[model samples]
Target: MEKESGSMKSSSQTRTEGSKEFEFTARDFERVRALIYKKAGIALAESKQEMVYSRLARRLRATGISSFVTYLDRLEQGSGETEEWEAFTNALTTNLTSFFRESHHFPILAEHLKKVKEPIEIWCSAASTGEEPYSIAMTACEAFNTLTPPVRIIATDIDTNVLNTGANGVYSIDRLDKMSPERARRFFLRGKGAREGQVRVRPELRQMISFKQVNLLADNWGVSGPFDVIFCRNVMIYFDKPTQGKILDRFAPLMKPDGLLFAGHSENFLYVCDEFKLRGKTVYELDPDRKTSSAKLRRA
Candidate 1:
């Protein structure tokens, strides 16, 4: 009992040194920012310290660690380090998304499909929770007016938890609030009995997508592509310019020369990447001239 009491006191001292509520310091915040940038290419801002503390504080408590520093140390040099890193990466990833987000893009996608005579391949590089990829499937169906459209979509993200959610293809009924009633009736089935207040994507739509956990910053994506279109939306805001440039460089090799790239409303890639030219609202087309220039530069 005496030894247990001493151990309890030591734990209390450790917590007091880096108290749960207010002990996250500037240095600690910088360390976290650096680590996340290195691991995931997410360039967190100084303003995000509170968010980091709130998100990671739960981790420290779950691990029974007293302070952020100690938790970080354990993360850096510990058994099960891979799992811990996955947890850390998952904790920091922001996965805010909704069905048919940026509705204008769908019409453009439909038109683009009309011009293609062959099978089309697409990549949704930041398909959070499955909404965007499923939306792509829906648009393809609408464009082709068929149950089994010839569109192949690869939807990927770094969060395994969300990938599972996306793969399951089930969502709360409230998720359909923003979607049109016709679309809701067409693409999703209302759950019944024990599954009330939920909906599942119809098998037709689910089969159109292949969901996987992919970290965009990783060395190899393992995805063979000459994709006709790539949807990488609302993700560049979290990365620095150099990281964004590197991603674009990698994307150039995976896309066909005439392929389209759709971006989020707030992301403007005009200055970040020269290989894609702004074609329309938040839409980019591969720049033939820049492609030639890149080839020349590589040879030189």
Candidate 2:
């Protein structure tokens, strides 16, 4: 699915002006691009200069640092407060998600559920705001025809702020506007009186998922795998080919032989990774012919 990076103005022209609150130069933006890539594996484009300035400016304001260079120097030197790095990373990360985004994938997942054994494990690799993982939980419920399905979903994201939101499992009522009224009534508890227009996911759905902060680029993701399904949708587009390949290599080892990998509608893993073969629309399964470690382990 195409990600929307809301309206942006070019930073090229803004560089010539002197009206900005913070002194954000081309080099500052470059430093940010480098640091984030090293820390999180995101490849920021030159066109994102404007977006960078706007997002990081809030950090400057919060930290009471008047200049981008000084703030960046602190981060680069690792002298800033321990939480500042978390804050900086959070400021730059973009999260755009809705319930059952890429609707086609959910039905595919539902069918896959029937074929798999009980006590299935799923990893929602980019569980922004909990919508995607909750959708998975809901799908599991529907597949088994029960509110308490034999499923466990581990929802992860790099941004701690969103992970916290997801763990809360609350959202504005409008987020479910597109869903069938029956589905909405079954899965969510509507807010009343003072809490009207807000809804919280049913406890059963919340219990099915565990939200955590995970940096995909790290040597250790801190999550044990061999997951039956891994939903890494709309995430690879943020990475360059090399980073994408590395992540995919890591993914293969953590998956069961027949486990399915669901990617974004727009992502194509066919050329980037040899461990998997395209199984359906942006869906991938371990390539039996590839002789990857995971496949070999499964056969052995």
Candidate 3:
């Protein structure tokens, strides 16, 4: 009776595991977690197993690979950079952004822009689909009361796919529903005829930003700074505390003494790095006591 019961339990477990098109064992999930962490500094939680499977399953089908093992092996064994690797990273990347996301930050940013007399340099560290950077540009324009603000924004992301979308500067008109109609009309050109239901950002806003592919985990971010503002919102939550500290340390040298760092609503930089102090809400400024000469010199 005991042996029969054990066999039935094993059979039930097998049926459960077999429900999906792909065989995803716990070990496969661990491998994915480790690889993504190494590649992108993203610390995937255990709860993400199903999400990973769902996303990668499409990659597996697209590549005509029969199993996760084979698909992962191809990625692991590949030399240097490959299209598949890019696809893999892009697939796993979660891009949830909208025009003027974290709306409160924009008002603070506008206030800061007004205080600075010099031409401004801003870095939108995760420019996903271009909305954030364009919003920044729009804010700058409004602060200065002109279509052309003396601001240059470097918008970058690790996912080249999204970088391409950002550079295109086109989106469905509905994406603008939250903005005041005047703001929307001022910033976007409505599509007509064949392109109905879409809107393109004004050329001035698009021109203010330069899009690039940047991996925060990389030794070199491929962009220089002395930036007045760095918008690193929502991107750090994916990284472990140590990775977040290292990135914050790197950010310190690249910013002016009075420069501001904008973090996500839930992110608190106070515990992560000592270089910055809370300025307001999620905004951070260089710690007065820890100000470095490089930062001061950068401003001069």
Give the whole-model CA lDDT for all candidates, comma-separated: 0.87, 0.90, 0.91
In candidate 3, which residue pairs clash? none
Tell me model 2's lDDT, rounded to 2 decimals.
0.90
Candidate 1 lDDT at 60 equals 81
Candidate 2: minimum summed lDDT over ten consecutive residues — where? 1-10
- lDDT for 72 in candidate 2 is 93
For candidate 3, the per-residue lDDT at 62 reads: 92
Kindly list the per-residue Cα lDDT of model 3 for residues 1-300, writing each as its tens digit: 999999999999999888999998899999999889999999999999999999999999998999999888888888465688889889899999999999999999999999976789999998888899999999999999999999999999999989999999989999998999999999999999998999999998889999999999998788788889999989999999999999998888888778999999999889989889999999999998887643544211
Best by lDDT: 3
Model 1 ranges off by over 4 Å: 1-22, 291-300
What tens digits encode model 1's per-residue C-alpha lDDT throughout 142-205?
A: 9999869988999999888888899899999999999889989999999999999999999998
lDDT per residue (tens digit) for residues 157-201 in model 2: 999999999999989999999999999999999999998999999
Q: Which residue window of length 10 is worst by lDDT in model 1?
A: 291-300
Q: Give candidate 1's whole-model lDDT.
A: 0.87
lDDT of 3: 0.91
Which segments of model 2 are wrong by more than 4 Å? 1-16, 295-300
